[model samples]
Target: MKRWSRAAVVAVSAVAATALVLTGCSGSNKGAGGGSSSPANGDAASTVKQAADVMAKVTGMHVSLTVQGSVPNLAVTKLDGDVSNTPQTVATGTATLVVGKNPVDSKFVFVDGHLYSDVADPGKYADYGNGASIYDVSTLLDPNRGLAKLLSNLQNPKVVGSEQINGIPTTKISGTSSADDITTLAGARLSPKDAQNTPTTVWIASDGSYHLVKIEISPVQNGTVTMTMSDWGKQVTATKPA
Candidate 1:
């Protein structure tokens, strides 16, 4: 009877120890997983500033712009193309414009501060004189008045959360900016009413690169504008149309 009691006590102690070890490991894992979804470094504004600084130095990238609803002084509804800021700011892409309730698609190239598009004259490129007829893609990369400045001018930026953008992990941030800054960055115009404190959201890569992955802004009445950037540092060449 004494031997049996001693054996039972030893067995109970071993079971309790195993349970404790397992509980500890489970708690540790839970903490680690929770951290992955939290804001990095616990400073959302600083992260945005860092991302802006990084993007200001990008040489070339692929960009996509989409607009839903009407934006004042902006005619292009969609644009997709490669842009390079090295040596000069240039772009080659396709654009969709709304003309009197109809959508017109055209291939265009911006070089030497001139916009050449087949829409202006079919089979031959017509110089639009710096894209006054349509939107200018190069303005999106202007160092002082472009995306970098927009990011730097964010008001009350806060980390929304973390998510994946095209298989790349990113931290989402929300903020507001002046209509003038937003329009300058997008090369668009907004009305006085729609321009007041536009709500903006941006996604920055969380992999320590701090690259600007996406930006969305609501700067029009019942409309939204979104831009996504990818293929960073890719080579882009734009030449004048013959």
Candidate 2:
């Protein structure tokens, strides 16, 4: 398999970082979800706010992502994993990466605030220290600072109507925002020029919990990145590496 560029690796590393950050100590709080097809009063902004509040209480979840044309030199076709936020955040999962024309298998684990990577070709494990970590997890799940802020700052959010995802009823919303806003939410800083415009769509569960079910980001240069989140309230735990 071909080697992945450092930048590419860091890009995907965001997955693990966010998985741990967003779930950290959130504590299991049951959501006030209803099976309604639309949000209260069918208001998009209110719906987003309500959903944000619901997701902020999630203790653990499962994430599946497909990143196509998002990063250069690395082709991350699919990634899936589980994460827990209560007490401590922990994660483990596999990713399918295509470097050049060859596909490589990569495994990742996050526990005790440390990140570990294993590549099938090398068949060895390397630890990326928490201090040197490239991705910032706290910025994603922080109710006041990260994704909540981004959603609150959404420009002209519009209701795209209701849809069903994975058999779950959801309210879809579409909007546009500066990439800088997202970078901040993800704990990344980009040069002004590099902060291209981004179009986003999000699906919030209508079951009353208003938890986020899916999100999509389309960058002018990188194509589209999609993430689907589910299994809310599931228990997840990670042990320190031996």
Candidate 3:
């Protein structure tokens, strides 16, 4: 299997998700939601407040999610599209993030709260690629993690703008990277292209739990990208291979 870089998967998901926003009735979080308040349209100041509020409720909490989203044009093809309503099941195990999508043709499971890529064994297990040490790749974009560094790909920087989602108003945020933000998001240094791969987008939510409802990423070199959260659940389990 070809290796899928974490940044490619996430940043694109960030963009493809935005398409989900377009499907709703006037971008309102009404028909489908976690019983939480509908997302709202607000400015950057309000967005940060919403993000902080929603993040406080569920951050670090393992939840079960029947997410029907897609990462189109992944690994190549510019990935300027999106997919929805697929049978994608996600289980955030108390210890790890486990995904199962028998029909979707893809599943990514994080082991014991860590994101490490193990190369296929050529008769024996060994490292691959540039041999860069892998950290908690799963937590890179998780709004709950407050580290010293943030990856250009994962950091949800200060709110930049705002837009309505699911019939609700929301705040837009730009996730830019500098020495500190990069360190806080990624725990290391990265080049500008790496930063470009990093996604910048708008966040939508009604209640405080800044549950990500919609996102759009546009990179100069790469095509457009987006991801949207269809539903949310809690205290779910993702069983992993022993």
Candidate 4:
């Protein structure tokens, strides 16, 4: 039997609400476990810079995403990754938002029109009504989600700490969040939390498009969650639906 996180299940269930697109990464990519980027690539010297450069190339593109709230309170993290600026690929012109997200878990989302997940049987999630597919959410993540702007606004995130994550050495950079750190996607404005209590830390990638290899978020009042990426597949030629 497969155990899907509640948030992941909801995201999978709601994927059909957005427009869909199909694209694939060029060149050969490895599976979850094949080889890994050398530890040298994860050096603090260039981790932040590398992520910035990669995100810059993919900025301003419309990307739809199905962000599942990992926390039990799904409502809080439901809209973790909302695409407002980007036009709806499947929903025509609807903005999908979810709240109540948790940290420390994998999620289900659209990957080039394909239902994919870090978990099992992800492909079966091709249904959510309204012609929405998993890839539809992928279209919302296009750098327009304020990722690059967040990174740029960061006061030089550094590798202040490190730990072994899935056998890979993960680094942490501590800093504060800001309203400007948030990016406006499609047409909506996403403002990062400005509370001093919510100290944010961005993980450093060893190599490739260092685009936020992972992120740790803590709430002001209480609670915390983390989002980690297990794959960095090639660019999928997905576009925002008109």
Candidate 5:
């Protein structure tokens, strides 16, 4: 196992949704978890509540992420992976790192309470500690404390407009939220220095499902981060790295 910097660990598990890209790992099983709720477009508040409920019931899905200027000194340009909810919390994906004028590829996997990344020699893995596993899988869709739950805490959610996400028409909403809230969504505890209330934007499916189609969060110093989720109700399986 390779040692990962504490800062990277914090960003991966604590601020991935707002300031990092790792939080994109999440999924669920409908039988073990709750089902989607009714879509509410009666008003902005109702819409958010409905979407939040639908998102909380997600059992498993694919997550595609793009982050800019998030991690200090590390310019990550792209990350895409699968988030599972059947077995245990696990997120496995590949990332594109931009260095100088070139892009580099790397692999990352979190399973069984352990994180492995950038494998170089065969059988040699850099371990990022057991605490580095993906955010609580069961609660990944929990409306009370899940990503949607955190977004609900944003101040004054307003329907900015509507847009098409992956061809699905979606209602766009924007609001302001605290960095603390973002960290809470990632399922990682944080210290005072890591807090930075930030502005956030979310897009919800307008077809009546109220599923979360996209989210954008911007912190003061960190660059803007955007995440797109799809394949709702999809099945995902993660195996421990060999």
Candidate 6:
């Protein structure tokens, strides 16, 4: 597998960092919400808000992401990792990138406010200044700017139905959000055309906790980005490379 350049990796990190922003919506919606375990009396907007609130307080979670199609500058096709937000935000994960039609894997760790990756120097970590600027996974837990905000800002939200995700019951909600809002949260630059209304879907745990389980976003006409989160509050440790 061919390793990508620093610039390319930076682009990949930006998108990978935004993987956790799956918790929120950005505008108002009108729809009847009724599900087996719907929150806020089966109101779609209310249910989404509750889930966003719950996600805001999460300290740690396991996240997985998959991207289909293209986004400017973003090269990562898949990422799986554990992220911690309390005390100090940190994350460690495996990232896969498609280079020249071939997939390459890399190991990454964020600790002490910097991103370290083996892509630049095979078998050794290379320092990438300012993890937050490069790939701030902590943003996923931000109440004001991350998932919470996204959920509250969702447009035309409606409770479509219910489904089981990873064996956990979840209520499904669908809506649209502006591309600009998503770009801000993800910290990735998107094409002007993508600034139009983007379709979004969220699945919140129906088990009363209202934790966010999955989110899907269509940023372009034929491209989709999906994120799944689990193991909320899990203990995660990221150590500086030796």
By lDDT, the best candidate is: 1
lDDT of 1 by residue, 102-181 (tens): 88898999999898998755668888888966886777777687888899899999888888999888999999999878
lDDT per residue (tens digit) for residues 1-242 in model 3? 99889999998898878777676654465555545533232345455554555543432322222212332212211111121111222222111112243231222334344322222321232322221132223432344442112211345556555576666555567664343343333333444555454555646564555665665544423434444443443333343433
Instruction: Decide which is better by lDDT, 5 or 6.
Output: 6
Estimated TM-score for each candidate: 0.87, 0.71, 0.40, 0.43, 0.68, 0.78
TM-score of 5: 0.68
Please give the lDDT score at residue 19 for candidate 2: 81
Error of 3 at 194 (Å): 5.7
lDDT of 5 by residue, 1-242 (tens): 99999989987776546643433322334443345432233367777878877776777777776766654333456768777655566777776756566676778777776767663433455775642242233344545656767656767888878889999988888877776666544433434454555678888898989889898876535666677889887776666676
Q: Scored by Cα lDDT, where does model 1 land?
A: 0.86
Q: Global lDDT of each model?
A: 0.86, 0.67, 0.39, 0.42, 0.66, 0.77
**Would you list the clashing residue pairs of candidate 1?**
none
True lDDT of residue 10, candidate 5: 83
Pairwise TM-score winner, candidates 5 and 6: 6
Q: In model 2, what is the error at residue 125, expressed in angstroms?
A: 2.4
Error of 3 at 30 (Å): 24
lDDT by residue for model 2 (1-242), tens: 99999999998999889887767534322232344333434888888887777767777788877766644322456667777756776777777766567777787677777766564345565776641232333344556655556676666778878889999988889987686676654333445664665687889888777888988766546656677888988877766545
Single out the weakest 10-residue window by summed lDDT for candidate 4: 88-97
> Which is the leading candidate under TM-score?
1
lDDT of 6 at 137: 61
lDDT of candidate 6 over 3-40, digit per residue (tens): 89999999999887676453222111122333233443
Q: What is the lDDT of residue 157 in candidate 2?
A: 79
Where is model 4 more than 4 Å wrong at Cα?
Answer: 1-46, 58-140, 180-198, 207-211, 234-242
Can you write out model 4's per-residue Cα lDDT over 151-234, one digit (the tens) per residue? 555654555766554555556777655533321221223323423334567776543445456655543334454545443333
Models sorted by TM-score, best on top = 1, 6, 2, 5, 4, 3
Q: What is the lDDT of residue 155 in candidate 4?
A: 59
Candidate 5: which stretches are off by over 4 Å? 1-42, 70-77, 97-104, 119-124, 130-145, 184-196
Q: What TM-score should be assigned to candidate 6?
A: 0.78
